[model samples]
Each structure stands twice: as C-alpha cells, then as structure tokens.
Target chain A: MSISEAVVMNGGNGPYSYEQNSSYQKGVAAAAMDMIKEALPTTLDLYHLPLSSPNPIIRIADFGCSTGLTPIQAIETIVQCLLDLIKPIKEPRFRTLEFQAIFSDLPTNDFNTLFTNHLPVRRCYYAMAAPGSFHGRLLPTASLHFAYSSCALHWLSRVPQEILDKSSRAWNGERIYYVNSPAGVVGAYSAQFGRDMEMFLSARAEEMVSEGLIFMVVPGEPDLVHDSQTTLGSELELLGSCLVDMANEGIISKAKVESFNLPIYFPSEKELKQVISRNEFFHIERIQTLSHLKMHVAFPTPESRSLCLRVALEGLLCHHFGNELIIDDLFHRYSLKVAKSLFFLKPESHESISFSV
Target chain B: MSISEAVVMNGGNGPYSYEQNSSYQKGVAAAAMDMIKEALPTTLDLYHLPLSSPNPIIRIADFGCSTGLTPIQAIETIVQCLLDLIKPIKEPRFRTLEFQAIFSDLPTNDFNTLFTNHLPVRRCYYAMAAPGSFHGRLLPTASLHFAYSSCALHWLSRVPQEILDKSSRAWNGERIYYVNSPAGVVGAYSAQFGRDMEMFLSARAEEMVSEGLIFMVVPGEPDLVHDSQTTLGSELELLGSCLVDMANEGIISKAKVESFNLPIYFPSEKELKQVISRNEFFHIERIQTLSHLKMHVAFPTPESRSLCLRVALEGLLCHHFGNELIIDDLFHRYSLKVAKSLFFLKPESHESISFSV
Candidate 1:
C-alpha cells in the first residue's frame, strides 16, 4: 500500500481507528519519544557540532510524520538534548544557538493537534507543517540539519489494483507476492518504493545541512524474496479470501473490490541499507531490529488476534481487497475465523528496524 | 553452546535432531517416500475422526522425534474443530484415538526453548505441551501407539564437557552436533537426544497398533550465536569497545576469546506435540513456533540491529542510576551513543507447533 492510502485508510473509521485515536496515539507518541530519547545522544554527537556552528540556522524535518506524533517525540527528545547541552554552557553560548524543526507528511494528515496540542507546551522551538507526501515535493535544498521518522516510512500510497481482479487470481490461497502479479504491477510498486526512498533521502539530503543525522524506524524483513514467512503474502491471501468470500456472498460487488490492494512494505535489513546507501550524504551509524515490539502488540488473546486482523483488513486490507465487500460482515466473519485460527495459529515472528544515518 | 548448555540456558532442545546429511531432511524427501508424503495429511486429519473404537488402537506416538516438527505444522490449522466434538462417533470408529505426542528435552532445560519453540507449535495444533520440563521420567499412566522420530532423538550421549568449555571460542562456532565433532562425541550426542526423548515419552505412554505416524526435520538453526554482534549484556558491551579499537587497528578478535553461548532449541512442530501431549492420550494436538526457527538462523548485519543489551541490562543500569538519571550513558551509551543500540539490530522470528489427541 502507498503512504497516501495508508493515511487515508488509517484515517477512515476502521478497526485500527485506535491508532488515530488520541489515547492510543499517545502510546505511539510515547514510544516514539522513548525511542528518540534513547537515540538522541549519538545523534547529537554526530550532528551537534555542525548544527551549533555560527552558520545559518540548522533546519530539521520529520518525513512521513503520520499524525505528527513521532515528530513531536523527536522534538521533545531534541529539546531535552538541547537543554542538557546548553545548560552545561554559559547563557551567552546558549543564546548563540539557533534551531528550526519542521514536520512533514501527506497533505491530508492532521497537523492541528501537533501545533495546538504539542508545540505550545515547548519553548524556544519553532515547528511548521509542511504539507505534501514525503515522496513528492515537500522541502527546500540544504534546509534541514537533521531528519527523523518512526513507524511510518513503509506505507505505500495505494494497493496495486491489478491484484484484486477476479481474473488475476492474485488473491488465491497461495502465500506469495501476488498469484502471478504481472511484472508491471510489481515493478510499479517497487519503482514507487524506490522512488519514494530516493525522494526521502534526496529530499533529506537537499534539506539537511552537511553532516546531518537521520534516524528512522521502519518495518523490515531479513531476507527479501527468499523468506516466505516474513512476506505479507500470506496475510494478504487471508485478506483476499475474506474479501472474495464477502463478494461471493453478495455482500459486495466484485468490481468495487477488484481495485484495492495493501499499501505496506516490510523491507529486509539488507533492502533498507541498500536504499540508504544509495544516498551518499547519509552515512549509516547504526541499524537494529526490534523483534519484541511487534510481539508485544500481537496476539495477546484470541479476541485481540481478531481485532488485529480486522484492523489490518479494514485499515490496510480494504485498499488492496477493494471496497465492494460489506466491510462489517466481512470483518465479523473474518474475526470469527481469526479467533478460530488463533486456536491453531502459532505465535507470529515479526521484526522491526531502527536505523540512524 | 552444546545441546546440554542450550537446554540449561534456554530450556531444553525440543524433540530430535537430523543428521546434517540426511536425505530425508532435504526438500526432495517428500517426493522420495510415500510414507513421508502421507504423514502430514493423515496425521493432520486424524483428529477429525472419533477417538474411541472397538478396534482398540486409538493411542498414537511419534518416537525418536526431535521436537515434533511435522506433527505440529500439519495439525495446527485444524486442531480447534477437532477438540470441540460433543459426542463420540458410533461404532467407536476412531473414538479410541486418544492422541498424544510427548516431546523430550534434556534434564537441564528450564523449558525455555520448549516454551519458545514448541509452545507456539502446540498452539497451532490447538494443543499445549504437557506442563513441566520433559526429562528424567515420563508420567506412568499413559500409553502411546505408532511411534516415529527422525534424525534426532538419536544422539549417542552428552556433549563432552571439555569440548563445551574449549578454550577457543571458535571451537564452539563449529557445528558440534554434526560431522565437525569427534566420532565419539557425535555418537554419544546423537544417542542421548534419542534415548532421552524416546525413553521419557515411551515410559509415560504405550504403543498401539492403530498405525500412527511421526515425521520430523532436524539439523536446523545452524547459525549459532557467536559473531560479535550476537553477544549481549556485559559480554556484548566489552566486545563492542574491543571492536572499536580493533577496527581502528584493523584487527579481528581471532584469539583471546573463550566460550560463547549457542542458545539452541529444537522440537520441530511434530516432535513438540508428540512428546508434550504424550501421544495425545493426555489432550494435546499441536505445538510449535517457527519465528524462533528463522530467528536462530538470522545473522546480524551492520544495518540490522540488536536490543539484547537493552533487554538484558535495563535493570542493571536502573539499579546503578538509582532514579537519579532518568536516561544516561549507562543505558543510552551502547543504545544511543555508540550507535550500537537495539535500534539497529534485526533478528528473525521463529514459529513451530504440533497437533494430536
């Protein structure tokens, strides 16, 4: 799925609507804050010197700032780091330092909460909402000192429509990246991802001051094509089957459902580094996978398992499964099946990555 | 680490081990033999029939099965429906089919790997491992029928203490369970894994004439955790500092290293269920977790990250900080300062399970 679609799907009232809710979103914000707090020291060690110089004010941006929570977290961490750095020095030295923070996301994202709710609480920091997809036009050249994003970069704009067609049989039970999805669809998605990544790095490169740091958390697999279990293909298959079943039951038309696809990608660690390396300005300082985080949120119980499946389907699956199916019934049945499946379903092995450049 | 140590550290190795060169372990094994091919379908559907029968052959067992691989995976998808039957079938058709598969681990295990590896596999089979470590003695009341086990459950005896404590850490890096170890060690090792799991399960249950099946796959997770990045806690911290200087000097720690931990676990989906459920006479159909399987094999790359230290040392740092430092180098240095934090590590997840009874 594409970033835009993920935002829209996530934004729409769905099972994962909790992610958009203020309370649940606060957890995300808090987690991001914790991550940033943990990452800031090294980030400062690398970028602080360049940023604190008598040069033009250093600008920083957060790409794919969904709900603007991660940026808020980053801002909070940076603020704390800056306070600590400046507190040790004289007031005169602190007065000479200038910093600007910018948050960017899809034009459709909600930034009001960030400005009205989060920014006002902090002092001596400037925040702005730069509207546009991170993959598209969003920032100016050499305008940023550092960049940060979390749990948002892997979103694609939309599901590949071709995969949903009945004739395509892309939704078959086989666990794979499309039941023979045409090279074109796969290429389009790959190119779009590559393009988005290039845009992300290039945009950051252009916007970031020399020797700037970029810390991001993205979902990834270890091996790309070789690992079937890590791929979303199986989940997609289950989702497709759910949708097809709905369509067959006359709950929704096949046509309406044939144009949707999932918009997320879990890149492998190799794939992530390869993308980062493509941009010369960003040097990787560290990269690691957080396996437990995903596990912590998964399959707490049979009900929770169904809830996750429903959330995944409604928020991400519908975009790929098409909208023709009666989402409510499909979700109900899907939840039942999921609950049943949970009885037999083994624990999921999920991995996430945190990287800094 | 040897199987014994792994058993101690992470619980016990589940089920059996495969001969590294076993043809039955290859992908071609299914095509090579009808028995193997039929194993999954027949065992998977076994629960669909009644349990009691005039035929007097309901109990089943998979002997010499190293950590029930085939059984759990085959039965997980269908175990729940099998367990909810309200009435026994007439003619006792398959009613006597009280199925159980006992998984045996070394006496030293805390049941960590069994829990990590076999538990999920059991969940898949809508079953749970018989609580408690499967070593020493099996329960005396149960009877097992149709026993089977592959490559593993055949280690001759214990891994030699000298080899385990070898002065060279590299010695631990070698695949001791296979050809790399001495003939005596291999024979002794193979026989032990076999005898332990087999004798333990067999003692608890009796064999039946109903023609049960046991299929297994072993010789797994070859990538032992030995590389510098895999080590965590004080060990990892020391190594990281050592590596920084080593990299500066262009030297590798080829020597001066002593023993390292392997943290190995076995119990393919089949063996876990078979051994733990005690031939299903005690009510367990499947058990497995595959996430750890892939995880155990995944090597950390520069781009991949590890959180082992944070998880392992969070408490230690907290104790020293004594609430004076909300976040400090003690916690953030390795995590944030050196760029060697949990943020960059990427480890694979495992999944396994079994089904019976």
Candidate 2:
C-alpha cells in the first residue's frame, strides 16, 4: 500500500470518537496533568524563563490535542507550578511574565466544550483551534515554546480499511488489545505509531524554540513488547478473549468483523525514549509510570472498578466494536474476566514516570 | 506516494557498495558472530538441548541479512556455540540435535555468496536463502529459533523518493541521508527508526519460536536524542556542510540537487529495545552501545577517514555535482579538510558495539 493510502486507512478519524467522549480518557488526562504538574517546576527551570515574565510572550501548542482537556489540564498544572515557583520571588517578578496557550485538534473535532466549558477564567490564555492532523505539518517553525500531548498519540488516524474489510482475517473479528494479535495487524498499528511519532517529533523540533520543553503523557508498558505478561499485554489478551467468546456465540458474525482492527498501540518507556531520542530536540528530564496512579483511580472500589472498565469498554472497545454486540453479555464477561486479571485490578509494583526537557 | 512507490524508489539493487564489499562488513559479521558465540552457552543452558538434537530442529534466520558475513558469522557462531556447549554433554544429548539456518536478504541482494562461501562447510547444517524484504514478511509461521541482523536494518529498503524529489528541499541536494541520517540532517530519522524497528520486531515475532532469541547490533547514541555532538551527528553535519558548500559554489545546480534527499538512519540502543520489546517473542538479555566499535572501524586511520569521505562524495555527491567537480575540486577540498580537521582523525569516542541477547 502507498503511504497515502496507509495514512487514509490509519488516520485518526474513526474509532477515535471513543477517546473523544471517554471518561477513562478524562481520568487518564487528569493523571497525566498531575504528572505535568510535578514536572512543571523542572520544566520552568530547564526553560529558565519565568512564566509570568512579560518580557516576551510565550506560545504553547498541543498537537493531536484531542478534546483539548489534556492540554487544558497541562496548562493548569503549568500555571500552578508557575505560581508556586514565583511565590518566593515576590510579586514584582510575577508581574513581568506573559503567557499564551493554543489548543489544536482535527478540524472535525468538537470545539464547543473547549471554548464554552473549559477555558480557564482568570488565566491569560488564548485558544486557537487548528483543524488538521498533527502527523503532517501542524505549526509554524519555531512558533511554540512549550507543547504537551497526552493519551492521544497511540490512536492511529484510522484502522486500515484492508484490515477492517470482511474478507480479511487480519482483524480476527474483534477489537482485542494488541498482545497475541495477528502480526500484520500489529505491523499496521506499529507502522502508524512509527509514522505518528516521527511526524510528532519532526514537527515539534521545527516548531519548538531551541530550549523549548515538550511534555508528553501516554499509556505505556515498561517492557510489554518482550514480556506478554505485562499489564498492557494481559489487557489485550482479555479483550481478545472477550471478542473470541462473542465470535463463538454467534452474537457477532465472524464475516462482518473479520478484518476489523483497533488503532491503539501502547508503547513501553523504552519505546517512548527511542522516539524522544531520535528527534534530538527534547532531552530526557524524567519519566514516571502512572499506571499506579491509574490503578488507584481504576480500582478504588467495585463500583469504581466497574466504572473504569465501562469507560475502557466504551472508550476503547465500543469505539471500535460499536454497539452491535450484546453489550450486557459482553460487559458481564469482560468485567468478570478483568476483575480476576491482576493486570486490571492490581497496582503495578512500579509507577510509570518520565520527563523530557 | 504509496508504499509500493516508496519501496520501488527506495528499493534498488542496494546502496553502500564500499562497506558492502569491504572487510568492515566482514568485521561486522564477525563481531555479530562473536556475540552469538558468547551467548550460545547461555542459550543452550536455557534450552537444555545439544547441538545435534533432532527432537526439535534448531531453525534460525537472519532478517536483513545483507550480502555480507552477518549470516555466515552467525551460522558459524551458532554452530560453534552449540558444538562447544555439547562437546562435554552426554552422547544421547548430542545425538538428538539437528540445525537449520536460513539467510534472508532483499530479492536484489547477492545470495550466491552466502551459499557458496558460508554454507558449504557443514554437512549437518541445512542452509537456504530466501529473497524478499525483511521489513515485509519473509518467513513461515513459527519457523525460526534464533534470528540475527546487524547494520543493515538501519538502512530502509530505499530512500523515500517523495523527500528526494527536487521540488522538496527536504533533501537539499544531500539526498535521503539527511532525512534518514541518524543525526544532523533532520530528527525525523527517529520516527523512521521507530517504524523500521517496529516492522523488524513484529515480523520476527511471527517467524520466531516460543523461546526464540534475537541478537541485533545497531549503531546508537547513549545520551538523550537531542545531543548533536555524537560521532554520527558530526558525520552528518560534515556531509551536510559539504553539500551546502557545493551548492554555494554552484558546483551542483540547486534545483537538480534539492529535488532528491538521502535515505539513511542509525538508531540508539534505546530505540532498538523499543522496537524489539513491541513484540513478545524476544527479551533483551543484554544491550550495549557499540558506538566505540563502529568509530574504531569507521575511522581505522587518517587515510581511512579520507577514503570514507571520498566514498561518500563519489557515491552520494557525484550524482548531483557531476564527475567533473568530484574529480577536480570536491576531492581535493574534501581531502584537505579531512587532513586539516583534527577531530576526524582523533580517536572517536563513539565506536560501534554489539548489543547481545
């Protein structure tokens, strides 16, 4: 297939709606924001610029900004950190700073919520909506000072239609997680990741100032590529099993779903570093695995756990699988299996944390 | 442009003839073989099988096994490792072992050398050469036990012509190397690395057995991605500067040269792991940055360094500037620069090394 065809097939238009309205996505964004909050002091230190300094206006952009909350949360954290950092420097130091924030998403994304419900009231932030894929050119050269993206890089533009076509077995008739998935399907997904990451870093390198800092928070496994027992892998297996059971029951005809594939790819920390290191604009400031944080929110209670799974299903599975399957039956099976699976309920021994300056 | 067009444009008989034909490739093959030798004892320890075990035939393949000694060295290493491991074991253990090694390269590569030079010696070792791009599928399901590739994987099948077309200044007459170059030309190389690595690991996962091992040696930087002081980065800058100089002198017409780009990519160890970990079949038993090793071989001496630059000029520059400039001013200037620049002659800190399984 040509890259153009591949782009059209894998572009983030379909199934992405899951992330658009997903409560789990919101939680993930919030957790990501918390990490951004912790890193902001360091980010400011590395950039060596006062957030409140009015000497020069600083502009920030979030590519693949999704619903814009990810960036909103990130900006909020940055502001809080700036406030904390400037508190000791006196009010005079704070009065000299000027900041501007830009939130970007696909032209097709709903921007009403961002403009109406989310923009911070007190902060001096301006919103400009960009309506194109970040995988290509998104911003002008050296136009951004700080950029942030969370929980959205993994979704390819769209699942390849070849994989989604009924004649193809590459899809295997379900929206399973990545592990134990077909090789071609995996290749397609990985290729999309490779392209997306390349587009991301290249664009950022050109758009960011020499010392600009880019902060990214996305779902990941530390070494899941090598070890299938990792949380991401197990989650994929669980999803696959659920899909397989549905296929076995005749609830969903195999032919209708044979080639259907999801556009998700959760990279490990090593993978993320590889992507970061290749661009050479961003340096590793820190990396933290927030899976523990995710686990905390995901498994707080049985009701919460159910809500989390429901969010996951609605955001990830339902987005891909649609409401065609027996929701109750599929949900019951998925919930029981996920509850028993340590990957879903247990907090990993390590927290996912990472920083790049 | 479609992938088919990209493949056709990037895919050719093969580029890099000097290294392809030089003892350097032989050395790379030997070094890879040495890694296999050292790891063989452990590999046997894990498998508890003898070199001659017939119960499960030891099937091995090398992805991107370019027309060099990688496969020959790997086969030799594996055979020697297995034989040495079993020499002290019981006869029953030895009697049950059988081994098969497959060497794969692009359909355009010269496989005759692999068959005639390497595979003839061992009666017990079965050898077969397959023609296809390793980045695409080339093996049967669960058909390989051990896979090894070195240096070659870094080279995408061909440089993406879209970036090279004169209309696109992406190459700026330097060709795809800057686009694909690990350093200096553009950081987009990282994304390319990620994509190539993803294809590599995903393809291998399906080809490898349950307990398969893959040992790969690739060029990489240990520091964060943004550091441009690395040897690879310097080399790219040198090349880019040289091209810019050529353009300034009007030795090469800007429009003709700007229409094409270089296609080359080198990855860091972190990037390699990210690629490998994406697939569950292989675990990273060990990873080492062999920048020192590559540096040692890449610049064996001041004369060798000059020769390397000359080759680059001839292979890459001559096409744009024409033979007249290459023979007259380009060679002399490049040679003089090489002689004057103490840094090129200095023992490089970043020598290429092997990352073993």
lDDT by residue (B186-228, candidate 2, tens digit) is 4455566667667777888776666777777775555454433
Q: lDDT per model, in order?
A: 0.43, 0.55
Q: What does candidate 2's lDDT look like per residue over A1-357, in tens digits?
A: 112212211112233233333455566667667676777776565335422222334667765554434557767676566556766774454554545565655533434334434554445543444434666555544546778777657666666555564466655346544566566656556666766787777877876667777777677666644533345546556656776778888777665455445566777677777776776556777776663245545455444444444533344444445667665676677667766766544655423332232
Q: On residues A1-357, what C-alpha lDDT tens digit does candidate 1 reach at each position?
A: 343634532433334543443332244445656656676675665333453322224456777665534456667677666567566665454555555566666544444334433444334554444555666545444445667776667776555554545565344222224424555545545555665687777767755556677777775556645433444444455556776777777776666455545566666678777877887667678776542344325445545544544543454545444454456676567656655552225434423333333
Q: What is the lDDT of residue A24 in candidate 2?
A: 51
Q: Which 10 residues in a row give candidate 2 chain B its minimum summed lDDT?
A: B4-13
Against the hidden reference, what TM-scores do the models get? 0.42, 0.42
**What DockQ do the predictions score, one after another?**
0.00, 0.01
Question: In terms of TM-score, how similar is model 2 to the real structure?
Answer: 0.42
Clashes of 1: 137
